[model samples]
Target: DVKVTQSSRYLVKRTGEKVFLECVQDMDHENMFWYRQDPGLGLRLIYFSYDVKMKEKGDIPEGYSVSREKKERFSLILESASTNQTSMYLCASSSSGTGGSATNEKLFFGSGTQLSVL
Candidate 1:
């Protein structure tokens, strides 16, 4: 079974402070993603790394950054936390696909991290 572990289940911080959310996946998947879920915006991808040391920006990359130093680890960094940044953050991992029809593979997700900035 694939397991995605998020370091924090809940976090609270005041505005202007820096925040770091960590995620680790046991499976040696080639793709890892970070997304933030909001009521109206839905799940917006922040960043994703297809391979170690290779990262691509997603739709909402502003105010966020990601690091994939190892195959099993990916981290999301918030330079300066703000009230508007408060949301439910999700980390997911999935393989590039084996057979020819692997493009539709499902992504395994972590429980989630709810961040609140005052």
Candidate 2:
């Protein structure tokens, strides 16, 4: 089965520290995405890479960036972690298959990275 793995399930850091969140997918998927899940705000995209060395900013790409040098590995970088950034972050990927469109394929997600900043 395809699985997405996040570097951490929980993390706490002081304000202004930089943070790196790693995500790896077992499936040879070409699309990877990062999103922050907040209580009332729902999942907001940060960044996404459709192929290695190529990326695009999502809806809420401010204060964040992404890397996808390898086919199966993608990374999310928080330039300066702040208290307001504390939230549940999820990494996901998709591959073409029985599903009609990429969206229909559905994203396989990592449990999530719960970041806490103080």
Candidate 3:
């Protein structure tokens, strides 16, 4: 079975601290994504990578950056954590679909990392 594992299920940091969120996928997926869940905002995409060393900024990438140095690993970095950034971070991996169409892709999601910034 495919599995997406997040390094931490819960995290807390100060307002100005730097944060790292790690994710790994057992399956050799070509696409990896980072998203954050908020109360009314739903799931907002922060970053995504379609291949090793390739990354693209998603809808809300202002305070977040991603690293995809290896095929199976993707990391999300919060340069300076803020109170408004406290939310549930989710990591997902999916196989690249034919013709690069996302409609046929199935994503495997991690349990999530709940971060609290104070």
**How much does each candidate deviate from the true structure in C-alpha RMSD?**
1.2, 1.7, 1.6
Model 1 C-alpha lDDT per residue in residues 1-106, reported as the tens digit of each score: 9999999999999999989999999988999999999998889999999999999999999999888889999999999998999999999999988777766468
lDDT of 3 at 53: 100
lDDT tens digits, residues 8-116, model 3?
9999999999999999999899999999999988998999999999999999999888999999999999999999999999999999878878775988899999999
Candidate 2 lDDT (Cα, 0 to 1): 0.92
lDDT of each: 0.94, 0.92, 0.95
Report the lDDT tens digits of candidate 2 across residue range 1-118: 8899999999999888989999999989988999999999999999999899999999999889888999899999999998889999999998755546555568899999999999
What stretches of model 3 exceed 4 Å from their correct place? Answer: 99-104
Lowest summed lDDT over 10 consecutive residues: which window, candidate 2?
96-105
List the lowest-lDDT window of 10 residues for candidate 1. Answer: 97-106
Clashing pairs in 1: none
True-structure RMSD for candidate 2: 1.7
Higher-scoring candidate on lDDT, 1 or 3: 3
Which pairs in model 2 have colliding backbones? none
TM-score for each of the candidates = 0.95, 0.93, 0.94
